[model samples]
Target chain A: MKSHVFRPLLVVIGLVVIVLIARFFYVPSDFGSHEKGYMYGWHRKGNEDEWKAFKVKYQFNNEYCKDCHSDKYETLARSPHAVINCENCHGPAMEHPSDPAKLKIDKSREQCLRCHYPLPYPTSGRANIRGVDPEKHNPGVECSMCHNPHKPNLRGMK
Target chain B: MITRRDLLKKFVKTATGVMIPLAAFEIIDPKKLFADKPFKTDEAKVRWVFLVDTYKCVGCGLCVKACKTENEIPYDANVTRTWVERYVVTKNGNIYADTPKGARDGFTTNRIDLGMGKKQDIKKEDIKKAFFVPKLCNQCDNPSCVQVCPVGATYQAPDGVVLVDRKWCIGCGYCIMACPYGVRFFHPKYHVAEKCNFCYHRINKGMKTACVGACPFGARMIGNIKDPGDPVTKILMTERVGVLKEEYGTKPQVYYIGLDKEVR
Candidate 1:
């Protein structure tokens, strides 16, 4: 009777250990759904702090983001947008970074379009109709030429 | 004796199991530091390259100012991303920076962080004129940041362009640590990894970047190395070129034309 009870309990414990081990490796470590919306990059995993570090550290971005997304930081640092925080474009992302791919940060062009297509950016000092002149210029034709991340101006980069 | 391969495998396994986020700082791993593979990169894409012509450069701060204004970058507490660096190599082999003049003319001193990295050496222009070199992203084939990224947020594309996918990014700033050029920056708002995409959006649509379009000196050039007959191809064939910190084996894509060894 004692052996029977011990064996079943041992089997349950073994299964739990196996599950934990599987979670530690095969699982992508990061998970969660970010519903913060584009205004804040709602997800928390891939966040704004990473973006700023990328801009501040490098002279010319050498694609530092690859392997773990050093691309945005690398490109923006060299481009005109290196000044602004990544959250401005991506939105709140505290939930996604820790959980891996739980959030879809760059799934569509909505976040970029908010500023790139003439939206009244709700950020502080950013509500001055500071949006893109989509009618006049093709964002597809070198958006970084005129706009910046820190102070994206429509008058073109002077 | 425990083989090196066994040690490496042990390290990777240990590292993967650890999964702890580290603060941004250069950690010279003994395993990585001792690797003898020169230019032995693990990157999975073609690398982007930049070729800056120091001789043709006109000490204009257009690139610097443009980079700031376009990036919305706040006034520097440290350095400027891309700017023209001017140096004077004299006839007697006395090297000097014709600054105050160069700074006034935007020839150099983008790093407002270090007394603007400025040293005044004004003299007659005829004795030794200043030559400008533009500093920006080298877009190395073997990037330090890529190797250092604990996660796979940063990646290179097949077209040789470096890019970031925000979704997988963790904002760890590891890439910020390993870079020798000091080109990467952190975003204030997103708290995620962001950098130069070669104006990938525009380039994909067949257009040049702002600096390239605004360069009045005809100094900046963008190219597709695949097209052998391109202007960059022609320049590469005839011009003298150099890169920064070659000892790191990063294989920087940015080439300096008419580079002076004494500039460092």
Candidate 2:
């Protein structure tokens, strides 16, 4: 090859080498397209483990509470509120009965009113929820005081 | 001297000589050439699907609160993983919508601020129709957020969930901007890009997503679309469903029942 041709080829080779070296150092070893095809895009293999090991705060199912509070669990199971999880109102049980020793119970009127508040959204299926006019329904009082959440039936209201 | 045809023939022979072996190796073991790591779940067998029955949603905001608590998002932060928007369409064809505090403190008033200086109360008689629609990360099949992440921090998992790698995220806010649904937000404390992942940890353990479990009115649901008997799959197969912003062609996995045309 001529001198000019050789010089340009050498320069291109050097640049390619530099780029390969940079990629080797910059990209993590565990990084690559994995499992499925490249449609999902490249990601570090270790990140999946990190996300899998992530500690979720909410006790997703109420079955966990059944071991500790069987009585309340049974009562709630039989009631219309069976669909409601125990941790939803009491807050997430991330490190409960150990770090805090107790879950803070939400006994505020606002908490109960979240579902019970009367709003005329007829199409939302909220009309079936048995809403009340907060002003007329014993105002300035906590609902848990009169109505037990475990047995939310009106016949058993305290 | 080599003729032009002879030179072309030589080049073709050399190309075939190199290509034959590579094609054979790819055909023999495509996985060996393409994939580096083995996925835990059967990627083909698991397609996570989400369903929202807008008709059943009472806009209690428990799902928002549950998501915040489950994901460790700060309670006071205005950004949220999931939110509920109340839409009020009046008699005169004016559309009004608002998401007050991400509906964390359920809707307290019927009057919408409309981003005006003062809140205007829409009279009950004048209202044509009103409804609440919950919004969350759609987990699109071809997610724009995943496409725009400069560092490849955001990716769609095998199960159709778009996840952000917090450690790898450069916090350029590119993914935040790319998201059509405006679901991505900076983590209040970590400052990395964040959005809903369908509560991956809980769902993997056979529990419902936080938002689904939190909804008292049975408005939200999650199931594997790959399974023949999965409720979400059944709903998708049997019911009339709609997705938001179909014109964008993101192929969102989240399905909506009774989705109103007024909802964006």
Give candidate 2 misplaced runs (Cα > 4 Å). Answer: A1-22, A135-140, B1-43
Error of 2 at B53 (Å): 0.4
Give one digit per residue, the lDDT tens place, for model 1 in B200-254.
5445445454455435445777776656677776777777777887888987777
- Summed backbone clashes in each candidate are 102, 0
Candidate 1: what lDDT? 0.50
TM-score of chain B of each: 0.67, 0.84
Look at candidate 1 and tell me the lDDT of residue A99: 38
